[model samples]
Target: MSFGGEAAVIGSRRLFAIHLFTATGAALALLSVLAAWQGDWRATFVWLGIALIVDGIDGPIARRFKVRERLPKWDGAALDFVIDYATYVFIPALVIALGLHLSTLLGAVLGVIVAVTGALYFADTRMKQPDNSFRGFPAVWNMAAFVMFALMPSPAVITIVVIALAALTFLPVNFVHPVRVVRWRPLTLAMLAGWLVASSWFLLTEPPLSAGIKTLLIVTSLYLLCVSGVQQMLPRRPKAGF
Candidate 1:
């Protein structure tokens, strides 16, 4: 192919990556919906968690390599917002509604989820630059943690965890965007490799390894949250004039 053709193809591939991220998020949301239909809380959590991981990185990945330039025709920002809202807010509430058998308590919980997430989205839309520092527990993480607890098969535990997560949803807590473009190197590659390996193992295997996979997922989630917290606490360099 000619050089121009080759360039066009590479650009197309980059755009494809961004689209793939959103598509993966949607797929997970769909999976959660299905899980709820079958009353499989475990499956719902698993899919919801997977979506969280993907949604967390999508935007950063797009910006990291300048994927935006590749698709002048497509609005990456808008696509991201749509995916984020659907996956983190709508899907989780739907899953919970189904899992809880659509009782009055379920309706109440769903309302809270929607309210908290809507506030988050409103904040995000007004941001001049997407803050690497989150101002809240992060709608996605709250949903993931709740889903995990829901799968535990203990009504008491699920109720307690749900309540705790609900409170957290409104409390400010930064979550890492999951990509640090400035520091892309061996460390970044290795961490990404770890995530891929762990997530793939969890998704591919069954039963006997379920407990282990859940542990790994929790650790990863916490690690990402911690990293974001530390970054936020680090003192920023003052302006030269100051």
Candidate 2:
């Protein structure tokens, strides 16, 4: 075979490997659900966190390797959506139902609301606007549920927040995609790294999250919420693209 042909074959193999790596995230998400089923909340969150990290990094990696261009036969975006729904919506909904220990009636209702709203949000192709900002609240149920669990707030607070978030799913509010938003990418990424550290510490530490870590989580969450809102109000310029 010619050198060009050999290079093409090698590139195809590399792209296939990237696909497999991306798909492993789904496996981790599945494991998180299994952990939740076994009533191991800590293990479940750990697995979910790993899955989140995988999801965060894989997009840039795929772009770097030109996975879509090189392997047009494989739909990485579709695969990502499938796994994302599992980890982001389904498992987190389960966390509310089982881990939170809400009343049977309320738990069932909230779980259905979360799952259905998330499904609808994911199905909306317009979720990601032309400016690369999420047009709605962005169904980040996984992160929301994780923070709620870590904080262990009053059930009433949890219920109110869950309902609010569910309603926000359909609202036309711009939510920043940390990696994709160029104006604040550096600050966003730095805060995200701190959040990961704080989250890991909170998860591993004994229950009833310490004052400092809880404060860290709250601050980080607020930063995300406020930054997204502020960014939406700012005039758009051709800053960067993902």
Candidate 3:
């Protein structure tokens, strides 16, 4: 082969390597499930958080390297979806069901609801709008499970929150895709970072989160919800023609 042909092959191999790196998040997520089964809640969340970080960075890395263009035969997005469902929905649901110590009936019901709603949400093509905002609650059961575990709320409150989040899966309300949405992106990321820190602290420490940390979390959560609400209320202008 000519020099140019050799270079092309090397570049393609590099892109494929990036694809494998992206899939590593799924492997980490699987390890998280094992941690949960071993009754190590801290390890479970730590692994999940690491997986989340991987998922967060891989998208930009893929785009920067143009992995799709380099490896047209492989579907990175589909692979990501598979991993996302496993880590974000399925494992989190399992953690909540087993770790939370809810009644058996309630735990089973919550698990089914989380798993089914998350799967349906993933299958919905219209879940993301042209503006790149999520058209619904976006099946963030991982975050939900984390919050629930940190708060250690009452069983009744847990039931209500779980059911409400599941119901929101089908609603038309727009949830901000922090990385994708242009408006308030910095603020969103800042708040998310704070929340993550608080969550990590709570997860690593003993049962209930500290009062100040808990208050910070609640404020951050409310801020994100309000941002979504405000954005939803604003009329969406027509996009320019291609």
Candidate 4:
């Protein structure tokens, strides 16, 4: 096969793999929500943790399969935008609406966080053609933090933290793209595994409301740390050559 043909084949496999991983994440998210609805906190945490694992793995899985190599710029951009919206917009709102009724202050804080996070997400979406670095906080990390905080009690404290973190997202900080380093892959996997186990334990043993809240906090916090820490720990991947 010609070089271009070989690349296309590799990229196609990778793209399909990424789609599968994304689907898995979506499935787990649904399961988590279902678990929460049933007042099975452990199950909820387990599923959410699984979803987080899927999210962590999808990019590397895509890279390993070389799906990105064949994807058209527009299609890739669209996929990224969709993923961001699902995780940042739909998932957080769903989690909050389902799990806890927020006070007005808490709602306001979350609203600001959502708005700022959305702006950053859109900024990244718009600047896809030239391969520019993202300028502000990553929506995924903010959502991860917000979700975890919500899982815990104290809507007031969570709101404060969210407001503070929302401001930090837009602050001038060097945020690296995550998919650059292989070392972090193992760490992320380990954390995800731990989350799964811990969440399962809580679901099985603890009181429903308490168990769910605790597991949610633990999983969310770990996820946020991974999102923020990965940027610092991993080197950025070089721009893909078309």
TM-score of each: 0.59, 0.92, 0.93, 0.57
**What residue pairs are clashing in model 4?**
11-66, 42-203
lDDT of 2 by residue, 47-137 (tens): 9889888888888899998899889999999999999999999999999987887888888888888999999999998898766778877
lDDT of the structure predicted as candidate 2: 0.86
lDDT of 4 by residue, 82-168 (tens): 655555555554454444557755665575566556656566534222222334455553234434533566777666655655565
After superposition, candidate 4 runs with Cα above 4 Å error: 1-21, 24-46, 71-77, 108-112, 125-137, 141-151, 174-200, 208-242
- In model 3, which range of ten residues has the least summed lDDT? 233-242
Candidate number of the best TM-score: 3
Report the lDDT tens digits of candidate 3 across residue range 24-130: 98889878988988998779988888889989998899999888887999999999999999988999889778888899888988988999999999999999887
In the predicted model 1, the residue pairs found to clash are none
lDDT (C-alpha, whole model) for all candidates: 0.60, 0.86, 0.85, 0.54
lDDT of 4: 0.54
What ranking emerges by TM-score with the best candidate at the front? Answer: 3, 2, 1, 4
| lDDT: the better of candidates 2 and 4 | 2
Model 1, residue 101: C-alpha shift (Å): 7.4
Lowest lDDT sum, 10 consecutive residues, model 2, at 233-242
**Whole-structure CA lDDT of model 3:** 0.85
Q: Considering TM-score, which of the candidate structures 1 and 3 is the better prediction for this target?
A: 3
